[model samples]
Target: MELNHMTEKSLIRYDVKETTKEKVIWTLVESLYEQGYITSKDEYFETVLAREKVSATGMEAGLAIPHGKSSAVKKAGFAVARLSNPIDDWESIDPNNKVELVFLLAIPEGEAGSTHLNLLAELSTRLMDKEYYSRLMAAENSEQFIAALDQVSVKEKEDKDTYEKTILAVTACAAGIAHTYMAAEALEQAGKEKGIRVLTEKQGANGLEDEHTATMIQEADAVIFATDISPKGKERFQGLPYIQVRVAEPLGKGDELIDRVLNNPDGIVSAENDTESARGSENQPANKKTGVLAEMGQAILTGISYMIPVIVAAGLMMGIAKLGAVPFGLVNEINDISYATHDNELFVILHHLDKFGFMIFQFMYPIFAAFTAYALADRVGIVSGFIGGLFAAGIHYRFWGIEEGIPSGFFGALILGLSAGYIARFLNQKIKLNKNFQAMKPMLIIPAISVLSIFLLNFYIVDPVFGGLNVLLRNTIEASQESGEIVLSTIIAAATAFDLGGPINKAAGAIAIGLAADEIFPLTARVLAIVIPPIGLGLATVLDKYVVGRRVFDANLRVTGNTSILLGFIAISEGAIPFMLRNPIITIPINIIGAILGAVTAVLLGAVQWLPLPAFWGWPLVENIWAYLIGLLVGTLFIALANIFIRHMLIKRGRMTITS
Candidate 1:
């Protein structure tokens, strides 16, 4: 866990050309790649870049720790480069200093926040001492640098308790790299100068160092927390007198903060009355605009994060059940599962499985909304948020079946989830209570009030607005069918793929069904819309490397993509619903465009699906079957290629990140 144990002479390089900031990082990561420390250079490089976007890793002196924790990392290791020229563009804690010593850490996702803190602690202790840094920089070669690191303990020479008072200190930063150690050293140095002993714990990127035990905490006079982030294990310091400030505060004003804490104690942070905690009160008002936007985005991502497993499970089960029954000619192809025929036992079982899957799939929106609210307002907001999601799913039109209902869909879920969270959070904060009555806030008051608010919001506003929207869309698509072929095809494709089986999709389907019954128009666009998104997304997973020259989808998403392609062929679009829910901004537009391109191509080429057959097996019955095949290929390829290229560009530009 220590620095000496994790690194060796091979990792130490000197006299590197520092042409630019990126070149220095590339050098270290390349060294790590050469040593089999990382699996993919691009992935690890992206991870390091992503961390830099969160906050700068450069410290007060010439030190920089590029903490890269990723699935691409094969081992927990580091490469050290002493640059020939200082890189001033590297954003350091102290703006005046430039970076020359770079430590590019390759840490596997599993090794983060645990084993690396010890290495940081040891290295930080030495780096804080100017004489040690001079000796380290004075090394002639990698061997001498390794030897200098191997010979340590100069910073820890003094007796354990050589001061008047003993206090506990914890330091942390947003990136949990350089500043945590810098602040820890600062507090310790300040303690020494004030004739006090400071036992500092660093909650660094890889782990906690010099951690406090219960015994040490019990005997301590007080605690000082210098952290930009909230310190871990804060419950342990429940009743202890403490002073909390930004992690960077200690680098210069450690003595002043120490004097204030020892001379005039700060307030207590107990399990009770958490609204008044220093962690919230001290940092909440820092930035209004940036904080709100970031928090909202994180809440949505959190919801999607929790909802992915549910959709994956349900969608795969339904797809497999339908596909399994296909060979026996027992699949409905329209309803996805055969209803009246239960002659074969296996077919009957598959039908039941399909039903099970469909039933589970329906909870995706509710779960997404509930968890999103949970992210924003904690446990108190879950009930109302879940109910709001059910409304979004159109399950709230209880007076009649889903055929007559008009759900607002994902947009509704977003508004209701955010509303429920803020309402619950506000109530929890403003509604003060005695201990006996406190339990009622979460259990009764917040849920009742929030759920009522959601009901009123949906009934009077969201549902009706979307219901009117669906009617308007149906009219427009119907009217468009009377116009030019291109206009009608575009309308049909866009509307059918817009919400992926939501109200707008169903509305388009209603018009298409009527037209087909009357034999008024070719159903080329209508049928293609049913399969394009699922098939396209699935093909994207397989063709990602062929198109973009690297794996764009992670291992899990690739599996989803395969399942989606399989389901799409059987006349199912639900397979790609998860993609839409997770990344709607990109996925929906692509789905619509791909469907439109393919449908319009088929329509122009005189490929006609007049009998409402859209499944792969029905292709032979279409007029100009060759054209239909070409259109299908065009649509699927476009979806695959677009997804791969767009995602790759975003990752390269450090705009989008793939989460494992």
Candidate 2:
């Protein structure tokens, strides 16, 4: 499809009166539907809204781009609304933006997505210029605006001289979204002006995109890699003359980058399966990150991404296994399913399935730490990360002569992952060898040094700090039990909600179970604490937009939050572990506060739970079920509200960025 033809007079609206974000979006989507660009308005509308909820599409100034990628889109097209009045409440990267124009794109589900992204990239490139932006905003009618957009779409690349040389480019970002393609477009456009054919391979969230075939690589004169993450199949570019730059660099310095590659010849990369050469700019160092906090957050987020599939699989399996009890009217927890293994065939099948879920659950820390380290130090960090994670999970602590060891939890994993990543990265840079022996660096030297460092750190540093804290918290829980029901409930609830399934949580459970077994303290507070965080965080995901006037969690998180709500009913607090791991500073305190509030409320209202059952099936066994429900509601609301407001403040202050 022609780029200019994507939008015509029919798809463009001028001086629209829609003042609300929803109304503007609906009006634009309806136009696309009427023009035969989409199959169904409802389907496309929901998809667009779903994308919006993931993260707002608002750019800088007065522009927003809300889009939907679905099979419901008949054609890759867009509907533009140049609003008569600004939409004040529209969520944007620039929080103070008064949105006056919106480009609502309907993207088809498959290969057409590349073309769709290219169009947006071109638009972004054009709008980046102040004069071009002003001219578009000053356009009196849709015709003028369409003409302005068409100038770049149809003529920008096609205007270049006939090509004699060929170049290949790879572009990527940390989020793997718009910037990846935008940089690709910039390089391609720059190469066009230089009379060179630039074929861009986008290594992004969509996976390896574009065809950089064997024939194409053989014929290429040079390669340009503008990436925040590692490009896939980079081995294919071995011995190729390549220039590496930050993902955002080519967007503005494309012409200069193209000139550098064409003029210079020392930048050969991947001879020893390493991409590093003398970097293009000494000012912009290789693997330079935004900041300490942002880099750490990005690594944790990468770990979380790898861990999500593990979580979803385990959550579903365990949740289904729990539901197996409903038909039998059993009053048993997840662990007791094995006790009934011989009693019934159905119970036997569920017992193994539940065990399988637990088995998969155990890999979370290792996978998380491995990927987190991978993000920072590449493959060299994997060994140290895995070993560190074992310590974090308390799997190998028995080697220290402790039979019952405390798991160091997510914080431990984070510290170790960072330590390993930086250590590996530092060593990789510092350790030098000749060309013949350099291959051993990634395989032998780095791994040996990294693992030894990790062992020393885990043994001397990580375990003692986290393990000691857990022991102290456990003692505190036991001491508080003699004070009063309120005091005991608060302590039990706080500890249980502290780390979800970590050492402190286990410690709280141990003391609480001992007290309950002796009939000294009922199991009311401990049971309530188990499900409160997951359910509360889930509720917060749904209610955050309404509370703070914008979405705090991204799309992936929203899905996790929904699953967490389902898992919470079956008494799985691990569903909310991602939230705590993602933002412990905010999520932990709120979790403790919420759990304490709920536990105290339930105790004060006479909700006594003496039985060991804590899942949904156990509610009937409680002494005052209504009080339990009321307490749950109060705590959930407090958690939801507190997280929303606090996170909103953090986002506004630029302390956090909600990635798509």
Per-residue accuracy of model 1 over 1-660 as CA lDDT, tens digit each: 246665777778886986676888888888888888887777788778877765567776687777766767776777899888888888766787688888776666545555554565457566777777777778888878877775654445757567777889998866565667878888888888888888888887666868999988888878888776556776587667777777767776788878867865555544332343434454432222246756776677778767767777887787778778668665554244454375667766787788888888778789988988877777788998899899988886765655688777777888888888778778766776776786787788888988999899888998888899899998898777779888888899888888877888888888988888898877899899888889999999888766665566655566678878877886767677667766788888999999999999988998989876677767878999988888888888888889889999988987776654
lDDT of 2 by residue, 532-569 (tens): 99999999999976665556786667778998898889
Highest-TM-score candidate: 1
Best prediction by lDDT: 2
TM-score of structure candidate 1: 0.82
Name the regions of candidate 1 deviating beyond 4 angstroms: 1-11, 33-43, 71-74, 110-135, 152-274, 277-289, 333-343, 399-403, 538-563, 570-572, 581-583, 610-625, 650-660
* TM-score of each prediction: 0.82, 0.79
